[model samples]
Target chain A: MTSIATAGASVTEQHAAIAGARPWQRLVLLAVGLLVALGLPWFVYPPVAMDIAAWALFAVALDLLLGYCGLLSFGHAAFWGGSAYATGLIAIHLGVPFPLAVLGGAVFAMILAVPIGYLSVKRSGIYFAMVTLAFAQMLFFIANQASSLTGGENGLQGVPRSFFGIEAVETDAFFFYYAALPIILLGMWAAWRIVHSPFGRVLVAIRDNAPRARALGYDVERYKLIVFVLSAGLSGLAGGVFAVSHGFVALPELHWTTSGEVVLMTVLGGIGTLWGGVIGAGLIVMLADYLASSGFDGIGIVTGGVFVTVVLLFRRGIWGTARHLWLNRKRS
Target chain B: MTSTTPTPRCALRTEGLTKDFRGFRAVSSVDLEVAEGTVHALVGPNGAGKTTLFNLLTGFLKPTSGRIMVFGDDVTGMAPERITHRGVARSFQITSLFENLTPREHVEIALQGLTNQGLRFWRSEKLLGRRRDEVDRLLAEVGLTELADKPTGLMAYGQKRALELALVLAVEPKLLLLDEPTAGMGIEDVDRTIELVRRIAEGRTVVFVDHNMHVVGQLADRVTVLQQGSVLAEGPYDEVRADPRVITAYLGEAHSA
Candidate 1:
């Protein structure tokens, strides 16, 4: 995002650099990660890769605000879950094209978040986190209570996977994986661009020291709002993908636990580092899947335990640790 | 120096600016009119509300009871960014800059304000243009061009101060406010800072709050001495230096410190 092409760092250069790096080189490690992500499904099942991709994109959205902007939202479930049900409803009720419906659902999520984010951004620290959580919980209850519109706890089912005219998006495990891969990749690419831009530099400035950013003549509120909307919109994209992949959308999609899970993914991947979010999401989701099949009666307890341990011992997360190691290696 | 003492439509004028914190006056009943193109100095001892006055003047502190006029517009309690947009950019006493960013990056972000590129991350020209030229020139002006690509956190104290000055000047404001631009610098850096400030004030209007009498004397065309939230004395640096009340009230505190 911060790279000037005239100065250099166009989206093409970024992609090319990723491609051009000598495989194990530093400049394209993230590119390597994405390549592995594309191929990782071969080793694992397609559904598993698709699930990780969706959650990874969602977690990246969270990382954008929480990690980069220094704003930790406890209500991202509003984007994730709300978009899921909304996409489901539009697909089932309006009979709209899947791609268009998902876009509409994303727009819906962005709009819904305006007031909540507006008011919440007025506060800082735990208050900001709590306000977002409260809004998310409110969304959860609304989803549950509006059973007629939402199909209650059972959620809306039988969502058409055929997004737009593309019949390739049906609920087949492999097809769904391929269908979601591009969107997820695009989301990650866009996010990576945003964070690397000069505009992205200002967000970090706002996070690191807001008073200074303001003193430098930045309308901090405007920057925060724009990114908030963008993050929510991308998260909404992930939600849309989720609904399409499963052929169902339920009220639990908006639940606070879902919100918490995204937050965990962001933090566990090392909040503020873009690639960390994806790594964290994949690790956690893969762990959850493993534990679920292994008859681990309480996945949350184990997940929670690991989360605490990571927070205590390795606060930077796996990706952050890698970056740290790389920086050190170069310096020495 | 050109003693024109620019009076360009009263670029930054405050009428009856007052601020109270918890029933105590931090800055009270103060009126200041800085001409459009001369360097004005606001000098006083520590704990005499110099920073508080700076905060109020820069819109960081809301006046309990007064109007702050910038470039002849009444912007009494407007937020800092609005005031800054209206051409009243300032530098912090502590050199508030993006630590992880290079001086080039910091200056570019500041330039984004002038170019109207807020929140449009993907369309930034930060690494090029008159923007970089301006940053480089300003860095050169403040003797920091050699370190333009260095991260701010890694710069020497003097270089950081110089970078902050470059950033403040980046907006090309009608008035520039410096809050202790020379604080905590070694004698050589302080001398260099005064030289840079004096060079820039030749064409720009400035009102800085500082404690160093030497810096104040070397740069100020006119001086305003503040003590306990009110003006103790206002005149040429020589006159303010002679005033007994100014000494007993503001300078006396510096003596104690």
Candidate 2:
């Protein structure tokens, strides 16, 4: 306990000492980030840029649970894929507009999340992860077997991007990119808002010391369940958007690997920092794109190598480490 | 002798509070009562069920067979958080804290819990700015104003205990269960903690378990000594300390000399 306290104290002191950069500096950084995000499609494939934005939103959703709530979910793809299927089914069957379809999908994911989170939040750490994974795998099997509804193993295809009677996004890549940006940005902002709220502070308190939080009259499990559902809703929203943008929802979206990928994105960018998810997602997506285009078949090996290096050397992932160094330098 | 009538002055009471772990009988049919606004101390040699009994009272553990009442309300088998909502709060023996959070944030979060706004994900924590003065007062009460902005993980051992006290106080609890608040503190730290407890115990009921005889001697208005699982003796510190069973329990027959 003493050793932990000493180490924590030093880390705290370091953060305090390097409380550098004013509010305007952060605003400028945000502006630069927005410009980069908006301008990226001109330099790269527009669809790829859209994929990064969608995945970044997905990563942020997972971070709400993993980072703020201190829950490590290994089966978030259940919500992601589950929402993708829901959005596709809604758009195809009901002929609803894209935004409403996405909302329907997100709401469906949240409904699924309620029971899953209820049972899963009962356990924590690896057990919690395993329970969520079990439920997700169950959903994956159902999606596979209900082929008529989900298109089964063949995947759900031809999810239209008709936003309020405008079908321009189907042929124009830039239109699709612009349509997806606001949704992704809104999802990210909501996540940011949650983490900075009183509710978010309690979630952090729970993550730090659940027993203490309980002793202080916070229903720790209830808080966890709420965050879990919120995370699933956000992930579902992202997945819904992705399904519409890509015009397909496949079985791979529900697979465990997809869940693992988001975890990697969160950790690689920096856990707990909101924007770290975006940076991490951008890096991974761009890297994978670059690798595939360059005829490099070992993208897994390269991604794994980067993950290992970041874990060992930076410990805070790419953005967190960079922020730490920047703050320290500013302090000096 | 158990009283038939529930006294408003009695802040906490337990009847036949028995707990068994695989038939090990950690605590057996113990009846305990604490009056309002007094510093009550539970002490025993190791494995005397001090911690277990504390857990049972604070709703951390369910008694195998018994009833726990706080201020005339049956709180037995209630959830810990429910118990806290009924004006009971506790500090852990191991110094539990939100290590990554600052002392100010810790107090703020605790204060937020009191406002029942802990689940408000849509509202900014800045809305809690209305409670900033209260947060500062708590930090100052714990003598942590200077270090309020420092992360609790970085706090010194004594400071952590103080922070824990402030966190408990933030709940505005009528009863504070402090488990070994001065367990591993140095003399100065111990003295400071005792003083802090003394100041806080003025209007609150404090039921603490302490291994430190000096702290118990200084602060405890009443002392209960346990041997094995049952109460060995109960009285003011001098009388309990003078009990032959307690003496035998502590030093065995050799030290009874």
Candidate 3:
């Protein structure tokens, strides 16, 4: 987000240089992204499209903390999987509408984030990552032992998608995608709005130099905690949606590897670019889906290879490097 | 240098300030008092606890045992931000800035800090434009108006220092603690900074640490010499400069160099 625009630079030039798109260009990009999101179900399986939407939201939420706030959370699965289980339980027992369940799940995630973020934000860098990971692992074990509530290894099965009791909506994949798209998009828009707001600017400053931020009379810890909670809430939203989409909540969702996978997706797309997560999620999810369909069991090998290539070739991830190129092109 | 009247109000006073780091007493019991609207320079040899004293006053480091009073308000052991809210602002000896941010953004952030809107996440950054005139004035005050849009990472050391000064000035602080304000500056930049400091020190109490005797001689109304974390001498620049102990402790090294 730190654009290297000099004095007297035009707004478009500055935007293009700093963010890789001007206002109109961004609108165009948004339009293209929307079209792809809408059309993906037609090209791929509708279930896969829903997965993309859900995972994209997940990556974007993670990016809010990792990219904008300079926090790397290695245990975000606690929020995602924890929410998935919550949404499942809420839907199963309460028989509420899936939207309400999702909302409840998101809130639960935020509540979970409070203590986790409070402790984790105090330690930075790898320690922050480790603290978050430890919390997620603890949750994973709790869910494992509480088989009666969580369905144990079998996972929470048959989470009903009660779209106001609409019969066709639950059975139809395309309908469900459209239904979940709004929530995912809303979450994404909120992330965009947050990173673009004055609060986000402070987050960027905190990420860049926290001590400087604190010295500037900002409560740096407070800012980190708030962002951490926000990110967890958004991640919970994505997880709740995913659980509803798949009609099941599995133990793997809360696993450390799932956390690692989302991190990989975020890095592949672009770390700080809010939209980059969507692209990264699209690639990884689609690749995994394709590999699964083709009976290729080595999904990790291929994804890991792709990740290495992206890190080596595109140090700024796909979108950041693209923005760099665009800026250089404009400069030249 | 303006001489204080009898019993001038203290802008900042430390009653036996002390800080111990893992058995090393970086700062021992030191009583420091700065009269209102005057520049006080803390001159000491390397590792003489000048920076440590600044840190304690600013609440970056909690004092081991003592009281820090800013404008007669007890501020000891308070957080740095709280200390700032009490009209005290500090600049680091090492320039600490958001490297990815522009000078304009830095000034805006600092200006935003003075009000209630800085923590508002829902509002657009456009709201900061209401203080555009103030931001521009501060930028112009520090001669950063032309380069305000440039990222600080791309800025020259002198320009970055100037921007840092602008940020500090934007706070409109009552008591300004500048740790090595002129450190790592070119000669022209140092002269410019001295002039800028002189201009801004009119209505504020300034405490600073500097090695350049010329800068201290030109700016400080009074000098406090420290040695091994204790106050050695305190007086006007000429008197302290000529003090035998002060010479043996600090200025002697400078004269030799």
Candidate 4:
């Protein structure tokens, strides 16, 4: 029954001490970003910032399961798209308040994520990723087949933004950005807190050494399943926001293409950097918009070519690259 | 928690443990009994199913037949983690430390076990002071205190062995199974490790696999020699080492002492 402190006086206690500091810093950065976002629409378009907010939340959710738990789910579009459909469906039919409809849609998306995440949890690595993809494809078909309910391939349209009785839609475009910005920032901040907590450390440990984590008396699979579901539920949260912001729920959002796009955003931002997901989402959304307007039907060609270049050289993404440069400069 | 009674003396026992991989026998019908408060050594040539037997005992590999008893509870086919929970900790023949993490963090994960808080995330780490104390003590025991914060990949040959032992020690098990605890250490590290293993585990049962005969003689109270897939010899260190059978297994011929 020897204690850890008495045993290793020389193994410096800096790891946790250093890692724990990042969270408070993240919170500060999030507060600053939220403030800027609140006023962003006065300068730029509100819809653009709102789009970035939704996509940012989506990328953060993806990173939670991918960066922390090490589950590479390529089929997350099922939940994201499903949530969009759910959000739109509830708003159009039930005429619930806009936030409540989004919440309902996200909950429905979570319902979908449960079974798929459950079966996929039994697998690991590429097999787990592929299994999720397969299940998502099945969902894509269900969205297609249930055209009457889902509005099919063409998608359900004219979703309304009721803005919690603000009558903001009648006021100006700036309304939705301020509303959605707080939630996305809060979501990212919450993600930071979870990943840095003892729980988050265990997830990283599970990812790196599952057998060891199991040996440490952790039901590693249970932790993985919980995170998987939570991340999916959050993605649904983001998707609900998307449908509310755009006033439409479409089939294309649920496609594997959308899943691939999120993955690319996460990777292109650098895998596990704290704000990397948000930054990645911003760049990708902006880049897609730029490419489409420039008459480049081959945005894929341009983006894919850039993706290859990034992976080949700066595999760490933007934040990672910045951190590395900071540390390297400090050292030299 | 030192036992007041004359240390049970019958800590871990195995009865007819067997394993088969696709109709090929890896380990068959092996019985091993180890007393409490003693360092028992297992010595065998390579491919003697020593690692396989370790796996069966630790619940990493299921026995096709037979039973494993720890403090007389039948733990034969239980999962590895469950077995670990039942006061049996192990080190793999191949090192199993978290490669991406520093050794200190690796040991903290182990210390978390000692704290009885595997899933407690909301509590402040300040509450884990006692567990952290034990982890540091074990690291110091293995002489790994100096290199603890370094990544496990940065560990030197003998230090890695010591770290592995500390990982198992984190659980402070009643019975410890070590696969090749000294398989790849230089002379200096091997001697340091042998002393360290004997010191902290003074009253615990230790079943370790080793290839060095001198190490067995110096450390073991009883020795079991495995050859191929069966027990070649089992007795006191001198008795087994002196046996013509064990000599033949090691030297490929019989010689009297």
Candidate 5:
């Protein structure tokens, strides 16, 4: 009994020590990451890189809600696709610059998110997810039926990228990549800051034991709503940027399948770790791209198999599992 | 009996407090008053509505057709957090802690609320280093300084109880509702906890429910015994213990043991 007790104590100490990354290590990793992100398009197709960055931002936004806040939203496509359509519409009709249009789209998506999030957060677990999914379906229906605004099935096309009042990025993928990279990085930084802040600590507490947090004088629902809105705004930012980068907003952007895809990305990369979402997004996007290029008709089977293996063997997702193993190895 | 004519300083009071689940009344109309700076123990047999009354007082459950007044302020139907904000904190009968968090993290989270920094998202948590001395003092008080960095899940049960008490004290609450604070503990742990409670209740008003009669007999300044869903007897521990209804409530279990 004494030996068992000692073992438990040591394991807990090691776990606590490994829970957070050291500041200098995080800084070094961030620097290396930024350099790789800046040079990534030079090696791969710039458009694909841009896609990865946008989806990475979206996944990070979802992670803020799903991972940190313990909220599983199944209708994030509303923010993504809704903002994409809004950004495309503004660019096509109002002749606004890309930055303003993306901002406008993001703001519009946040406006939509307020009511949806307010209602959805009132429920929890599968009910919360279903409510979000229901709201997204509603938005999808609106986008499809409003053919004059959204272009129906054909989607909103001919979205000109007016870069800083100059149409320099209209046809240049590299210019678009440079422009989108900073926004994605900023979003990533925001998520990291939130997770490290006092507010973030409360979020984790709520995630762990909400009733206890409430008893400790935290307005748990208010915190959940704040995170939900923040996640939606970030997601909208990604969608708006994606619309500008691609110069089009398709109906599929708002589809439930799109929401599922991002969820898959977050889970596959790792859930709670902020960078896990980015890695998951990159992996899924790359896998789908490769499958499409190789004429693999059964991409779903392969992806499903990968997901099953990850769930069974590495439940913490790729990054979390890796960190856990590395920490245990170091301890031993 | 001659009653004193002094104005009673009640820290917490319930007026016709009742709770109904569907149609079944778990706690019938119950009026309770806990005076300021006293450790009041509510004792009852299993399912005698002790936990439910504790929940009603702490704002975990809304009272049906009643008012909960804390220091003369009617705070009925308020959210649990709001009640906590108004200087009430509680612990569960079962250990309810963030299993993944270290004892230090649990205290820090509670301190975040107490220090009014719970909403500060942009600042680094290390800014709370200013209060490191206070956190250390609290941990030391509970004799948990050695296990401060350990995750709560890995701590021995007695350590978790101490940690929970430290967390409850972190709120600097005027009223504390501790549900079975020393429910399942060894004799050493129970004695230590009784001492800890006695020390902490120096200025604060505490309402606790416990199954351990010895701890209650030692710590409670006054005792209220519940039968079914109503208070059957109220007096000093010895006086309430001798009450026929109170004894009958625990007759089979006490005699068997």
Candidate 6:
């Protein structure tokens, strides 16, 4: 038998190297991100900035499943909106602080994700998307019919924001933005930690080749379900914050369109890059706010045009493509 | 039939194993026994159920009516991962790997399975640094030490195949089922793989399917020849190669090709 060294230089190594972010690059990106996040409200309207923060978290949460786990969910609105309603009810009925209420709603979303993810993870690609979409639509119908509990078409309004019994927020959007920023930032940090963890590597393995992962002794379905639940809980955190910040949980929150919008934001920013989603959420929210103020009813047309361009031109999404180029240049 | 009949120590055994796909029998009633600590090769023409048998042994497919036992425990109809837990590991005929992951990452993921920490999403991946020595050993064992940090997508087909073998070795299974360990390889890679398999097969039972007779001749301690999903002959490689039925089966496949 020959030792491996002698077989030696006979084998050819092919294919382009996939770029990885170094520790310094990640730290620098994080610092820049913190600066932008803190300085956004100073430049933009406080309400719009609040929407950006909430939606950014939502997009990051969705990207956890879609980009990392390779599971595309078309009905994430269930968790986002479901958490909003749960958070609103908890705040209004229990009179707890906003953070406690938000945490409670996020937990509720995780519980809901258990069954949906259980059934949906068995499926792949378009079928998985359809299963999630169907479940969200069913929840939408139920919320509309529950009338008294959900407040029917009018939604749950006057969802007060209290900070440990001290009315610090006091129905002030600007003040609420600073408080919610930490929670949203926490959710993003959790998402980042997950993708860089051992479990996240397994999720990527499963995404790359499920049967192969199974042969390696990992439970592919269980991993998928775990990530799905985690993503939902994080999304719920964002939705809960959005509800209390706006002091309302409306029908549009649960609508399929909201689900579509978040997907758009994640893809536009970059599906697998956690930061890409924040950039995406920020871009879409700011664009929509600007368009609405300009009395531009065709906001969809412009957003749709941009989405088409991104899909056609920058297939890896904004942040993904940028990082790819940056890494390639560094290598050269 | 006698009470004094001696049973050999077998690493894997199948009794009346059969698989039917919509009334078409891919594998007929097949009883196979592989003694412990040997290289066993399954060779047949295309569509003769060689891969199917490998799949059956690995729990990738449930037999229609049969029993599969590994190291004396019945693993019939068990899940693929459960079969792995029972000290059986397999490599795919086609290259199956995480394209974006590095070879080191691949070995780490497989090594993680041995521990209960694979699901620790909250802990840093740097914790896997504890297994750094073992991971390096596996990568170097397969001659991928230099390219260990490169993503598999950028690797040659042969390098990817070598990585697959490394992944299987990381589990340190008692029995290894390799499907076409040298399929679609250049002459040099094929020779390298043959020597590599010979080195790795020490003290472990190996069951592999290959179209390359050279690989079979060089590595197989025993050969089981299949024809139309049934065992046509079984003996040492030299004896099996001399059998007329085995020769005819090979000739038949060659003619068709």
DockQ for model 2 equals 0.69
lDDT of 4 by residue, A243-294 (tens): 8888888888988999998888887776756467787888887787788878
Badly placed stretches (over 4 Å) of model 3 are: A1-16, B1-6, B255-257
Report the C-alpha lDDT of model 5 over A261-317, residue by residue, as the tens digit.
Answer: 898888877777677778888888888888988999888787788888886787777
- lDDT tens per residue, model 1, A186-264: 8888788788776687887887678888887888888888788888988998898888778898787888899899988
Please give the distance, in angstroms, between residue A124's alpha carbon in candidate 5 and its true position after superposition: 0.8
How would you order the candidates by DockQ, starting with the best?
2, 5, 6, 3, 1, 4
Better lDDT candidate (1, 5)? 5
Model 2 docking tier (incorrect/acceptable/medium/high): medium
Which ten-residue region of model 5 chain A has the weakest summed lDDT? A1-10
For residue B35, what is the lDDT in candidate 2?
94
Q: How does each model score on lDDT?
A: 0.79, 0.86, 0.87, 0.76, 0.84, 0.88
Best by lDDT: 6
Off by over 4 Å in 5: A1-20, A165-168, B1-6, B114-116, B255-257
TM-score for each model: 0.92, 0.94, 0.95, 0.89, 0.94, 0.94
**Which prediction has more favorable lDDT, 2 or 4?**
2
RMSD of each: 5.2, 2.9, 3.8, 5.5, 4.2, 5.2
User: DockQ scores for all the models shown?
Assistant: 0.44, 0.69, 0.50, 0.32, 0.63, 0.55
TM-scores of chain A in all candidate models: 0.89, 0.94, 0.94, 0.90, 0.93, 0.93
Query: For all candidates listed, what's the TM-score of chain B alone?
Result: 0.92, 0.94, 0.95, 0.89, 0.94, 0.97
lDDT for model 3 comes to 0.87
The C-alpha interface RMSD of every prediction is 5.8, 1.7, 3.3, 3.7, 1.9, 3.8
**Candidate number with the higher TM-score (3 or 5):** 3
**lDDT per residue (tens digit) for residues A91-168 in model 2:** 988988788888899999999999999999999878998999999899889989999888899999888787775667
Instruction: Go through the candidates in order and give the clash count of each.
Output: 8, 1, 0, 19, 0, 1
**Model no. 4, DockQ:** 0.32
Kindly report the docking quality category of candidate 3: medium
